[model samples]
Target chain A: MTRPGRDEDPDRLYTVTGGRSRSTTGAETFDLVTLVVSESAPVRGMQSEHAAILRICRFPTAVVELAADLGLPVSVVRILLGDLLAQGKITARHPRRAQTADALPDPDILKQVLVGLRNI
Target chain B: MTSPEISPPPAAGTGRPAAGTAQPVTGTTRPATTGGGTATGTALALLVSVVVASVATLAAVQAGDESARTAIAWGAGAAGAVLCAAVTVAAHARLTNRSLRAALAAGNARAAEREAADNHFADATVPTVVERLRNGGSAETALAEAPPVASEAQRRVLVTLAREVHKGENMRAAAMSACANAAGRVQALATSMAADLREMEHRHADEDVLADLLQLDHRNAQMGRIADSIAVLTGARSGRRWAKPIVMESILRGAMGRIGGYQRVRLHSTSEVAVAGHAAEGVMHLLAELMDNAANFSPPTSEVHVYVEEVAAGVVITVEDGGLVMGEVALRRAEQAVLGEHGDLTALSGTRLGLAVVGRLARKHGLSVSFRPSAHGGTGVLVRIPRELITEARHEERAPAPPPAAGPAPSSPRAPLGAAPGTPPPAAERTRPAADHSRPDTGPPRQAEPVGTAQHDAQGHEQAESGGYATAAPPPQQFGESGLPKRRRGQTLAAVARASATPSRTADSPHGSRSGADGRADDDRAADGRAPAASPKKRPSGARFGDFRRAVQGAGDPEETGQTPLPSASSPTRSSSLSEDDTE
Candidate 1:
């Protein structure tokens, strides 16, 4: 479908994916909210983006959040992460599903916050 | 699963079921269309079409002929047609299979190109992304190692990121060093220019030329100050030094002399104590900057009043201006900086660094600075100089009032007396030998009592007091000894008037005058008896301006030989009011 003679070629999403739409790390798929962290210190001669990921992921950071921080698309972040994960440099885990009922603040904690605010 | 904050089991079991369906679609769709299944399906469809065509041909042939011969001929034709159709189907299958193989090869090549392009894009975008990441934390240095990742592209990106960061750091350091070097060169050039101007002031005995020279000298001081401030901000030392302790009044006047708006500053009370030689330079720079700021920010017609008070622990110099009042935020920021809280350089207003420079100098010298709203509807800055830098040198003599003479030290007291009659007839005679050389710029010449007019040596003290510092010993004072012909004396007097009019050659002036005028040397040594020996690198300009003032004072007397008893009468008061108040 690509026009060969056109001067301007719009970048396709598959270009970032290396024309393979799926992760190569077996059947495991990367979720948007999966958290990732560097498992070891960054080594020399790695791609700058990889080193940057290692630098930013010293603490646990979500896949979507990493994409936002790196200013890359989510799909690109997923691919880079899959590469990092395969090498054992970074580790990823799925985010916990939301449980609205359990996540509500305790009444006692709310009372304490109210007291703190009034004191201020 | 590893992180304590996030629960992982629910996401693993229930999240994004659509993501699962995507994997099977990719798994089944490609092979179903392009693999052996497509080949088998195509073969089966061809077979069915061939069978239907053969049956139709046989049925038509059977219906067409009843005779044995006709049936045999029709059967033979039908069989030929079936063979033709079977051959066509086989050829089509072969061509389809060959084209499919070529398409598959082309797809593999395209995938390789897309992967290469992906790597290229990644390489180009990594540096900007890495820079943003580095700015997020100061602990980036701790991230000295890159993790092990299998992807070669990812590894290269990390390496480029680290290199870019190192390059940026190196550039910043180089810029800072270059700025420091430029500031130092400017300071040196200003100092040398000031010295040369002083030397010129020494040779000229005309009042108007000397006054213009003094003003130029002041401008040079201001330039040196600006350079010094920039150098200090860049973390270089302020290299100015003084040879001996100087009176607080001398320091104040020296600072005042450097500013353009000196006439608008009104001095109130000041301390009698002297500043130690080591801290003298910083004190002078600091006061000059504060007063300069005060004068610059205020309305032209409004006066800035300065008050100094000696407290139990130290001395306080207060400068109050009548400028537009500062906003609360700006005032608070200024006060924080003055009181040792450094604001971000980028946060400071682009127009002014005066406060920042003042704060840096104050912090370096252990001085406390503060800013407050003034009664004058502007701002007041109070700078407190600690007691350590203040020394009690009230009666110390031998510290010449201000080291004024920059010429070759007069080897002995009699040298000037011996040299006066021969030394080119005192500069005033050579240029403008007429009686009415009163400069148009200086308005009317005010005649007053001429002190010690009989000998150049006798008038050294008056010259020091009147001319600031430079005119004390050289040309005019030397010319006073000879009662040359009336015209020659008039020339000498004009030269002397010029010398007297030059002002404020304080502590930083060259000590070269000490050896030339025995009378002034003795007076200086007696004035600050405990003062240390002068530095040899004294700025020559201070001495020349002092000498120029004495020449001016000397010229005034001869021009109005019969009119007034006032000699050293006009300019001396303004200068001595500074020195005299210190002694009191």
Candidate 2:
């Protein structure tokens, strides 16, 4: 484990998220598997954690990995991600629809498509 | 609710003390931080080379043996330089085996390049180059100073000396750089792991698991310090820089947390002091290395006592180990190590590496760390930090009030410590006379007014009331004295006053002694209640000191010194704590 590196103490976690532990319930929410792609490069004088997040998300990335890369808790990273999404600095992609191979396709839709092809 | 890592620390805060000192102060004109006015090895080497070279030149010219003259000068200059610095080189074998062998081989090579060389040279050049190498001067520069010559025996002699010194310096430099780099990488991974542990520590609810994680965290902190030693020894600045000043107590505790035997370390006392943020890391690491040495050397049963006192020179921290005392020779060896004398690799390999680390750090911050025999029969280390590196700790947290009075401006960080009586709080700004009368003039004016001007004070209070409730602040001091026990509360309050509330009124009432006592008791309570929480700016630098003196000095009767605002103000001599002479 690293020794306490309090020297890099930033503006502090409270001020970083405006005391909001969770993302606001609006557009662009984040989940563990949600993907984030940075639209802009990190610039000088940005909140260090935010800059780190921007630099890490060079390609579409997962919220969990971002938390690991930034060395911050998922909750903190979610709040930071929410902020970035709101600022349009990054885009988040939702998780894919869940399904299993055992689940069958609707037979009626398949038959209708077959008849339409025959008619053509 | 206490985490084991957090419990023993004096004040609350995250402890991430880094290792390493700031880069060596840039110029040579200034005395090296290693301390002392005597010339350094580098300077003395130059002086000796010039003197020895000139004497050798004069002797050779008298004999009229031109060829022998240069050789004699080269030999004397080289021998003189080494012998001069050798006076301080405690361990003669400090020069690596590789360098010694190279020098011996160069001597044999020089013997072959005898009479064929006839070129005249600057009398001092060859000897100067030899002196440079022996003093740990860079090899490349030494070679450039006096180049090698195959036919000229004197030049060959100078060339060999330069090459030998280079071999030793280059080896040490390469090793230190590599060690620092490796330690840095390890600390980075450890930092990442520590962050993860912090996260796990929060998510886990099982008491047993949490305890396990705490152990891992402490062990990890110890490892971080070990890595830090490597970087510090290499003379590199590593780790976090604090932007806000950290109180002295917290810095001590942070150092304790980094060592293995922290539990046995007793931080007995710390007066009000704060290290400016930039120098905080170096000071913390320096302390950690010392504490670790103390705790490790002392018996497990005995406690290591640490006392921090504010003195004129700066803050003095005394770390005493209650174990066997260090002998005179050992003490001198350690003193030299910290001062950064001797040679580059004197004790880098053995157990003395810790001392080397301390020396490097002490020099980096210009802190003077000296050792003296302690009363407990163990070694006592005194670390004196210069005043320039400290900022007054803002102990005025509860005093959130905005600046109510106009005279004491906001936050003068270094407000001429002990704002001695010469700059007493302005009389017009205090309006003490007015506040005395305004005390709900309905309260029967409890003060036994020596001057019988209670009515006048009431008028001033009435006028001040219209401007703001400003006059309300002074009444508590007037009314609170008789109602409370004075001594215990008085001293305690004086400590909390942050050196700002001692008005000159304490120094000169007709009842000089009595009013001083009563007014101070009331002032302590009044000041505590009125401390502005929102405006945690600086207070009068010596106000609290003035209060300490007032409380300690004239403990007079409340009735005898009855509050009349003791209109005469600004006598710094009333309480002597106001004088902070920069005495080291």
Candidate 3:
């Protein structure tokens, strides 16, 4: 399997594995082992299998951000994003609302500065 | 109880499919009843028997009932009855079933054909509507002309064509290619209209800008005229008597004021000469014009150097700018054009008249104006005026001494300044005599010589001394001395006295001892009997003196003052002596 280029984003990773089985005519002893793979590692598989993994791993971005970053028309981006969503390679989340308590400035400090400036 | 609705079975003669089968009859199959020759022959025989019986009956009716005729009629009646019954039965079968079925099939075919025709009409109607709309028909008219509902195939074609039209395909190309030719024509018309509208808008905007530019031109011309008037007024106010340095500063200030922030850095270099002369005003104006030109042409951050220098014949004022470095030939052409020596002013300023004014004023003042490439890779304007003009003016400023008398000799006696005379001692000697005379005498003491040689030496000494004084004076004096007749000597002397009263050190000396000595020498020469010939020279050519005095007076007067009177003949001759001294 080929590794991703250096410039590729680190957020997404893919891994793949494969095995072949064989049977002996007569066997006196047998052995079994288990192996684990990490998501960041390159796939130790055939090229076609790696390609299939890449096809599955491809994902879509949000329409607005994609349009702005790519300098494409919003209408065009919307259409492309719709197609990607239909392919089920991406997910989206609604943004959360701001808390009212976080938006206000300190009234006491504001009044103090204004009073000091006026006195000067 | 209901009666049975009897109907004959469909004719076996009609070649249709067996009732339940999916396949219809093939073309090879014939009508079963019509193809049976036995059945057709039997029907024909029955028809003939019936007709023969009817004929026998008619014959019997026409003849009386004889034995043979009666017998024939009875037999014919029996046969006719059988035939008539058979014929009637056959005709009833056809009417009841076969003919009715045939009529129903024909009616079904007709209905199907009408339906197909209606569909075709619907397809054709859409194009007709589109064609009408393309030919400048209204949407409502198009809708009225169109069929109420179009077939699915036709609707698909029109929608696809419209989409192509929207994608910027040429209407004519779409028209010739697609089925909806009329729609394409309508699209072309709409596009043409839109393009025409855009062009009209652009033209209108251009016209508006042109109008605004014309208005701006008018305003600029008015402002230019105002600036010219201000320049003239300032020149009149400063006049020729103003200090050269001060006038130069004022000219620079005027240029800066008129051009505002467009002025570049001040010129720090000092000139070889101060531009001191009667033509100072003219020189200032000329410089101002050049500075104005430089300021107008140069970028605001660039530099303009106004340099003044003395050249072989005169003072040169050069204004250099680090902008458009015009070639020497082009600059000359521009200058000549401005001077109106067949040079086109129109070419220089186009419609604005600044350079022309500068050239006119420069020419009026007798200043030589030309242009050359500057050291800083820019155009340089050089204005040179003769140096004699400035020097002559300074000499005329000193006072004139009394004319020498014809008779006696007094030697080694000092007289109060301006009290005795034959021209005042040279202005330079009188002003700073202590400085000059205080130096140890540099030459060997004079040795007595022949009278002619002695006189020649004295005249030569006087000429050299006068030459220095004349150079120190202003320009008008020099010009007048060169041009005027010699009869104005007394006038010249009086004018000189008035000028000396003004601020020079020459008029302040109390001991006028030098003049008296010179006068005493003139008298001694007369007593020696050689003085008569020298007397005419010593009499102080009144005409020359008068001319010099008048020129001085003219210089003193303002430019607006009326002309002064010319000197009388005796004064002219007297003034001629001063002119001769200057020439020498």
Candidate 4:
């Protein structure tokens, strides 16, 4: 799915990835629901697409969102993120705690945060 | 699994009655184990049914018979209750075993699915890893094998995986083909552009503009060569052709024009043989490659000589150089390069594609090329232009015919065809100095221009009359063999100056003639440029009558007997005695 564009030869893809479809971990470490963040700037000789991915992932972002922003398929994006994660170039975690209703900050704590914000 | 779903709710009804009788046992065991509760409840239900049946039988016997029938009925009820409990327990154990086996099977299926997913990833991931390992100097690492499958479902997954791999292979092949197709299209576009530029070059007339156009034309030819190489690589036939045969001499000149250091190339023994129109470009390419190699390998100061001769089978072109002697291996390589058999891609890749392209063109045209050490101690390449590609050069016949009209005017009845050779030496020698002043190589640059234009017109006429044969420019021949008195050379030089002054008209007819009262007015006009003061009788500049007279005079004089410069210039003599008096 959208591995490369018309001018960029698919053969170049084979050379870039060495014909491997995913990261060294074998399975995708992150999925559409998983959030990812860049750990560092990309290393040299990194592919343009990979560098673009790093630039977009400064903040924690869902895998599906990254794929959408990069104009690549979800599966291909997952593979790229998996490579970065394996290399310690990025980190990923499930945003499961954010889904829990009770984990929201208390009103009194929010009011204090608001006061702190006004002071700043 | 469906059977359990459909019957479990209804079966719970039966469990209720047993639940009451086995209440304590069921309640205690239900929290501990499902198997225990179902077994105990089943037993109690069977016991209730047996007791109810036995009690009814006893009541009926008491009412009908008496105390003896009552004891037998009670004993029968107890035995039936025992049998019912054992059967219930056995059935419950069997149902539990089946449910456990089904659960194990489902677990196994899930594990297999997970393994298959892992295998698919491994199939994609392993090759790159192995390739990396190999690239990293661990060449022994074999490719990762496919993960083993466990069930029919996994086998189906494997089949799908295989199809995907093939689809990827086909996609790569299609991409490669598309790249090749794009290359071919670019080559075609470049070739057409080159042709257009050539047409533009011919239309331009200004000298400086034409020079620039000629340079552009050379670049376009270079581009065409590159396109031809690409086209040949992509399996397309060469696109250049000639409508009519071109002589080997002009072919050599065309090839020479494309190369630098053309001034040092000396062509010798070129025959009046023309190559077939279709094979002209192939011959041009072959000669250019060989000549370029000669120029490059030889010292810059030295010359490269080419000889073209027609043999029994075909035309043989020998290219000789004066340079370092080639080693045995290099000679073999040069030989192989021209024959098109050097299959090593690396050797044939870059600028060295010159000889490889030559080989390709040669093979396409059915020509043979060989290399050997020259007599000059450098490499010599001989290309045999085969009989099929060779034709009779048309310009030779035309060159001699213009001089025929003078033959009848100067001598006997059969003079035009035969005896004009007996009397025309003085006149032929007279025209020699004129041919010299008009020659582009020896004459001043400004004088060369008009002579060139005259030659161009003459060539146009030859092309028209001969149905489009490209002729070589006339080479200057020395007149020493005519044995004319050297004291009269000054007078001949003056006559030459007069004749060369009107180059275009003199070029029209190489032999000027005087034949009045004959209705051949065209011949008279062609001969008008000859000076009336130099000769009382006018003659065509191309007349072979002078050459024929030199031939007869040489036959009559013994000293000059075997000394005709060209065989066509002389005839066999009868007595050879008149030459002795001339020598004295």
Q: What is the C-alpha RMSD of each candidate to the true structure, in Å?
A: 37.8, 37.4, 44.1, 38.3
Writing each residue's lDDT as its tens digit, candidate 1 over B1-584 gives: 12111222222222223223233433445433443443444445445644565566666667665666476646655564455445444544454455456555766786787687666546554544555444542224413433343367665766666666666656665676687789988877876666555345434433345456656766776788788877877777775565556666556766666676766777664355778777777887788888998999999999988888999878999999999787888789888766655433554565677777788888889988888888999999888899999986533121332232111111001011111211122334323311122212112221211232223322432333222222223322333346441223323554455444422222223422322232232222221221121112111211221233343333332233111111121122222332333233
Docking class of 2: incorrect
After superposing candidate 4, which stretches have Cα over 4 Å from the reference? Answer: A1-120, B1-211, B340-347, B394-401, B404-584
Query: Per-residue CA lDDT of candidate 3, range B147-258, in tens?
Result: 6544566656555543443333345434434423333343334323322332232122133332343233233322433344333322322222332222233333323333
List fnat per candidate, in order: 0.00, 0.06, 0.00, 0.00
Candidate ranking under lDDT, highest first, comes to 2, 1, 4, 3
* Best model per DockQ: 2
How would the docking of model 4 be graded? incorrect
Q: Count the backbone clashes (under 3 Å) in each candidate.
A: 72, 21, 54, 20
Q: In candidate 4 chain B, what residue range of length 10 has the lowest lDDT sum?
A: B410-419
lDDT of 4 at B575: 11
When sorted by TM-score, best at the front, the candidate numbers are 2, 1, 4, 3
Q: Write the per-residue lDDT of candidate 2 for residues B394-513, one digit (tens) a residue.
A: 433113212222111111111111211111123232334224322332122224333322322222222122111122232123224565423212123331231123233433556545
| Candidate 3: regions farther than 4 A off | A1-120, B1-265, B268-278, B327-329, B342-351, B391-584
Error of 1 at B580 (Å): 43
lDDT of 3 by residue, A54-109 (tens): 22222211222222222222222233333333444333322111113444345456
- Better model by lDDT, 1 or 2? 2
